[model samples]
Target: MFLYTENFEGQKEMAMAGLSRALAEDRVDRDIIPLLEKINALDNYFTTSSCSGRISVMEMPHFGDKLNSVWLGKWHREVFIEEVFEAIGRHRSGQLWFLVRSPILHVAARTMDDAVKLLNLSIGLGFKYSSIKSVSHRKLLVEIRSTERMDVPLGEDGELWVSEEYIGRIVNLANAQVRRFKGKLKRLEDEIEVLEK
Candidate 1:
């Protein structure tokens, strides 16, 4: 996937470009409306932070970097693989985790690897990201987290963490996962049936 950023484009617009690219790919067969919803959840964070007053356009600069860049990273890009990137030197690496329990995901995930590559990274929804460490799954049975990026305490350098909120926004991700899963399983079942014929 390629990255595209515009001077005046908004977050949704930038995300839509990625969504459109993903949707237009010939390799993507099944519908992605549900997955798109999951993607939209990411945008919700912006609105929530703004409304909750946890974030401000003025304070953003002190917290994160490059808030104005319109990122157009591919679904499989790794520039922002995880909440943070680890690795000495100029290279940084991170992990992407999602609940594959959804039936739809089962199908779409047939050819997918355990991890997703992300790029066109953006920071600043109100959090301090310095010397990013690791991106591991949270302890929740059905939820996930970016172990590295977190909310800092009263005076700490960084301690911010995104969990319940992120999970809540992505509640429907499982739907697509389930749908894809079942679809692929059905295809396999159909192949078996054809083989018998």
Candidate 2:
């Protein structure tokens, strides 16, 4: 018999409620909604958090300083060069970076077996960074992620470092990454129903 974590049903309920709240607030990524819903519909899995990935221009005091970081501009879809320039224009202090991140999904599984199954599926679907995030009596968490990412330092303080042509080049690259991940997300959505079986 498969053993689930203690209060698994209760935790799933609470997580569903949180997802509902995020949806109502428009805080959930639009592209990831269908995938999250499908996972939540399954008996053994529920998404705790997800991002369909993003391209952004950000300002921070230093690298990895998320607490003080500010998004000068962010997009869930392909971005244009003009949009990037506008975001860079807003950067006044601290480090400026052009970033691209692949889709990420955090799922809570009912059992360790369920977690492993999902993790393997995710990795097979090109989420090479997928892994079992945590394991305990409380929950088995699986993190579905991809390796596509870029962190290019644009400038610091009020100075501009790169030329417009450089920005344009990165914009094209970021768009390509966005298309690649979106394709992966689509494939995952198509295959996720297999988990229900």
Candidate 3:
């Protein structure tokens, strides 16, 4: 058997410097900062990217055209039907979409073992889509993700495809998904220190 040794010194230094910049700029999301810090405090891990999750109404010229997507409203937590309606009222010349995304986190680990540990922890914590995203001499990345998502088409060209009552129904479902995933995120945050033990 071949022995594999990984040196994380260079990447760890870079990750710390980047974390410092993000902290100084207030670029990190407030709710997840404690988790980020906890992970970074471990010698074997660092976070490259993360989103606590969100629900939003957006207008775009076409599907998959995120470059031109305009956000009418976005919320990190569950939202009320009235709030989404207020956003829909702003829709003009584009496809209007109501989206719900689950929490996502990209973690860098010092070794394959480290990556696997985090990946399993995330899946156990309800991030069902957790996996090893990439592996190379320079990095081992574990992507922590969940299955809660929705991409419902609300309208196109400033017209509503569904009635206001229908919007209310979808909003309720989306909010429920939001609550579920936020709880998962919190559990992962609470349990991440287990990797260090």
Candidate 4:
């Protein structure tokens, strides 16, 4: 049985509840305890963060062959999102580098709406102007400068490469959202104080 919260606060509360429930349900299932512990710890990281970084991270395969469309399955998306959530729950700073299949950039940046929509999504996901970068161009490969944990590299034969750098950026992007949210909280606090006086 898995229960997640609607957001960070709920995550924290549910994690605590999960811990109690797990402890009672299986005194011998020690493994469940550790999982609950980890989830509980994530509360601090998640609560401190203001917005969610729902990244549209993608990658291309077979740039040298006939493959043109970026292939991302439903299960792949879920795992990616879960991995990102955990990564963000781990760190306080970093960039969210979206490793798309080298050609999504052309598709994403083809129109004004596309670029605007991307930026809007980034803002909604807690971007700090400087924390977003995209790596593309299969034929014109540029060396990526990152100390990430997850990297998915696609070869000429179309083998997806996953690395740490990609994973690390989730934390970075989430930290950015936290900072943005904190600012909003401060403003609200100040306004409330003024009204009280």
Candidate 5:
């Protein structure tokens, strides 16, 4: 048997409550809900946060300025080139960027052994960036994440730098990435029950 962190049950309960609230508010990603439910059903784990990956066009005051960033368009599934153009049309005064991010899940494990088991499983499922994020008597956190991503600068200050052809090419690439990660998520969801053994 594994030794769990102090107040692990209490923490799991609180996390579940938070997840319920997020669901009620439509803040949780739809594609990731089934996977999250499977993980949460286990005795040793509960998810704290997650994203089912996304393709987005964003505007920011400057590079790496997340606080001032505004999303012109965001999609959890694959997108069309025309949709991309529409988002670009909304861009005003800021640095515009096109981005694709892979799926990420932050899980709180009941113990270090559980954490490592989940981390290894996630890495094997193509979440190459999976790792133990933090360890303490209060919590053991694991980050399950993939490496597929793209950050392309589109323009600045209401200026368009890339052509429509260029945007089309990047849109194709982003869609491919979206398909790839969705496959991985499916595999992980199918295999998650193995952790119980």
Candidate 6:
């Protein structure tokens, strides 16, 4: 049988440098900083990227055109229906969407065992979509995620496709999803210390 090996020391040096640059640039999300700190404090792991989850109303010229897309309103926490209405009013041209996204954290573990441990713990903490995202000699990455999500079209070209009542209903639904994912994030944050054991 053939065996595969990895240079964890080299990977750690690269990851540490990357993290330092990201921190110096203020690229890490503000809300997730505390959790990132806690995780980095552990010896066997580091973070590559993360988003603490969000609910947003976006205006775009077309689907997937991120270069021109504008966030009419965005909130990292739960949103109010009135806020959605305000965002909708700002749409001048193109499509409008109300979206709810689950929390996501990409963590790099020092070894396969460490990656698996983090993956299992995330899944157990209601991050049902968690998985080992990638594995190679350079890195073993675990992606912590949840199931909550929504992508609803509310209008296009400065018009409203749905009634205000319908918008309200969708807002409530998105809020529910936001609350659900936030709880998962909190649980993960609380339990992430287990990796140190």
Q: Candidate 2's residue-wise lDDT over 1-197, tens digit each?
A: 34467888999999999999999999999988999989999999999989999999999999999999999999999998999999999999999999999999999999888898899899999999999888888878999999999999999997989999998999999999999999999999999989867
lDDT of each: 0.25, 0.93, 0.87, 0.31, 0.94, 0.83
lDDT of candidate model 6 versus the reference: 0.83
**TM-scores of the candidates in the order shown:** 0.21, 0.97, 0.93, 0.21, 0.97, 0.88
**Model 2 poorest ten-residue lDDT run:** 1-10
Predict model 1's lDDT versus the native: 0.25
lDDT of candidate 6 over 81-137, digit per residue (tens): 888899999999999988888889888887788888999999888999999888776
Q: Which residue pairs of candidate 2 clash? A: none
Off by over 4 Å in 4: 1-162
Per residue, candidate 4 scores C-alpha lDDT tens digits across 1-197 of 11221243544454356546646875323422332233234322211111111233332333232254332321112234565444333322222223321101111122233234434433343332412132232111111111212333322223223455655564465445434443432332233222112
Per-residue lDDT of 36-92 in model 3, one digit per residue for the tens? 888988988988888889999999999999998999999988898889999999999
Q: How well does candidate 4 match the true structure in TM-score terms?
A: 0.21
Pairs of colliding residues, candidate 6? none
Instruction: Give the runs in model 1 whose Cα sits over 4 Å from its true position.
Output: 1-98, 101-160
Model 6, 166: alpha-carbon shift in Å? 1.5
* Least accurate 10 contiguous residues by lDDT in model 1: 48-57
Please report, as a residue range, the 10-residue window in candidate 3 with the lowest summed lDDT: 1-10
lDDT of 1 by residue, 38-85 (tens): 433431211100000111001122334336321222221112223221
Point to the candidate with the largest lDDT: 5
Best TM-score among the predictions, by candidate number: 5
Q: What's the residue-level lDDT of 106 in candidate 1?
A: 14
